[model samples]
Target: MRISDSMRLDAIVRQQGHLKEQYANASRVAATGAKIGAPGDNPVGAAQSVRLQGALDRIDAFRESIKTPKGDLDQAEGALATAGDLFARAGEIALQGANGSLSATDRASLASEVDALKTQLVDAANTKGQAGYLFGGTSTATAAMDAAGNFLGNAADRTAEIAPGVSAITSVSGALAFSASGGRNVAADLDALRTALISNNPAAIAATVSTLDASRRQILAARTDAGLKSNRLDTADAAHQQTQLSLAAQRHAVSDADPTTAYSNLIALQGAVEQAISVARTSLSTMSINKFG
Candidate 1:
C-alpha cells in the first residue's frame, strides 16, 4: 500500500492534537482536585453526589433550627427552677404563719417577705429567651403574666423542626404552668397566702400549704418537659452531624480526585505529549529529507 506525504503529515498532526487534549484534561483534574468537573465526566457519580449534597444541606438547616429552640428551653428551665425556689420559700412562710405562737406583728412581717417573693415569682414567669417570653407559647411577643396575677399568655405550644418530617415542642404554656389550668393559679395562690399572713389568719394560712405544693409540682412538671425537649434537640443535632459526615464522605468519593493519583496521571500525560511532539519533529524531518533529496 502506498501512502502520500500529505496523508502521513495529517496523521501526525491528528495524533499530536489527541495527545494535547489528554494532557489538558489531566492538567484540569490536577488543578481542580476533582474527578468529576462536569456530569459528563461520571454521570452516575455526579447524580449520587447531588443527592448527598441535598441531604447535607437539609441536615445543616435542621441543625440551625435546633439552636434557637435549645436556647429557649434552657432559659425556660432556669426560670422554672427559680419559680420552684420561690414556692419553697413561700411554703416555709406558710408553715411559720400557721404556728399558734406567732403574733399578728410577726405574721405581718412574714407577709411582707411573701409579697417580695410574689414579685420575684412574677418576674420569673415573664422571663424572656432568644425569641421572646419563654412560657408565652406561640405568643412570644408579650409578657406571660401581668402584675395583678392574671395569665396573659395562651395555651398553645411552640414547636421546632429538629429533622426531616420530625418536630419537637420547644415552649411551655404559661396558662398551664402558672394558671388554674394546671390545677391552681400559682400567682393567685401566692396572693392568697400573702393575704392570709397579713390578716394573721392561721386557718387560711394552713389551707394554702396544699395549694402551694400543687403549684410547685406544676412548675416541676413544666421544667421536666422543657428538659425532655432539650434532650430531643441534642439527639437530633447529633444525628445530623453523623449523617453530614457520612454524606460528605460519600460525596468526596464520588466527586473528589485523589491528589497522588491525579498528579501522577498529569505527569504521565505531560510526558506523553512531549514525546509525541519529539516524534512528530523527527518524522517530519525524515519526510522532508525523502521528498527533497
Candidate 2:
C-alpha cells in the first residue's frame, strides 16, 4: 500500500488534465450550441446530420431550378391571354365585314385593321419570357413564329425538375398553339380573314369567323394546359418546402445542443476542474524540500 511521491504526483496531473478537458468540452458546447463539435464527439449523430444536410441542400437546389420554368410559364399564360383577346377582336371585325351593305372602301379599312391584328397575334405567339421564347417548345433560343406568321418551333415541350422523382412541363408547344397541328392556325386564320375582307368576299369572310373561333379555342386550350402544369409546379413547391422544413429539424436535432443541459454541465465541470486544481496545488505545497530531505 506504500505509494511513491512520483506516482502520486503523476496521478494528480492525469486527473487534473482529464477534468480540464471535460470542462473545455462543456464550455464549447454551451457557447456554440452544438452538441457535436467534431465527428468524434458523437459519431452516429454527426453522420446523420451530414445526410440530413445533404438532403436540405438538394431541396434548395431543386427550388432554385424551378424558378426559370415558373417564370416562363407565367409569361406564356399572359401571352396566350393576349392572343385570345386579339382573336375575339378579329372575330368581331370579320362578322362586320361579312355584311353585303359595306362597300369596298369600308372592307379595305377593315382589312387594314385585321392585318394589324394578325401582326399583333404573331408578336404574342413569338413572345419571349424569362427562359427565352415562351412558346418555343425545345427551341427556346429563337422566336416561335416567323415574320409571316408561320411556325418556327416544334411540338416538343420542355420540362423542369421541381423535386426528387418529380418533373413538370414548363414550355408549351408553339406548333400546337399557333399552327394547323393544334386544330387551327391562329395567325394563318387571321391573315385569311384579312385577305377575305380586302377581296370583298362575303362567303369567305363569314367562313373566317368560324376559323377564328377555332383558333381562339386552340389558344384557350394551350392556356389551360399551361395552367395545369403551373398547378403541378405549385404542388411540387409546397411539398419541397415541407420536406426542407422537416430535414432542417432533423439535422438540428442531431447536431444542436440543449442549451439548458449544456450550461449546467459547463458549471459542474468548471467546479470539478477548480477542485482538481486546488487539490493538486495543496498536495504539491505539502511535498516541500524539507519533507524530501
**Considering summed lDDT, which 10 consecutive residues are worst modelled in model 2?**
284-293
The sequence of per-residue lDDT tens digits that candidate 2 reaches over residues 1-293 is 98788988999989988988888899999999999999999999989989999889989999888777877787888889899999999999999999999999999999999888888888998899877888878888998898899888889878777787776777877788899999897888998998999899988999999989999989989988778777777778888999999999888889998899999999999888888889888888887554777
lDDT of each: 0.89, 0.87
Top-lDDT candidate index? 1
TM-scores across all candidates? 0.95, 0.93
The alpha-carbon lDDT assigned to residue 44 of candidate 2 equals: 98
lDDT of 1 by residue, 1-293 (tens): 78888898999999999998888888999999999889998999989989988989999999998899898898888899999889999999999999999999999999999889988988999999988988877888998888887888989988777888887787877777898888889999999999999888999999999999899999888888888888888888998999999989998998899999999999999899889889988888888656775
lDDT for 1 in candidate 2 is 91
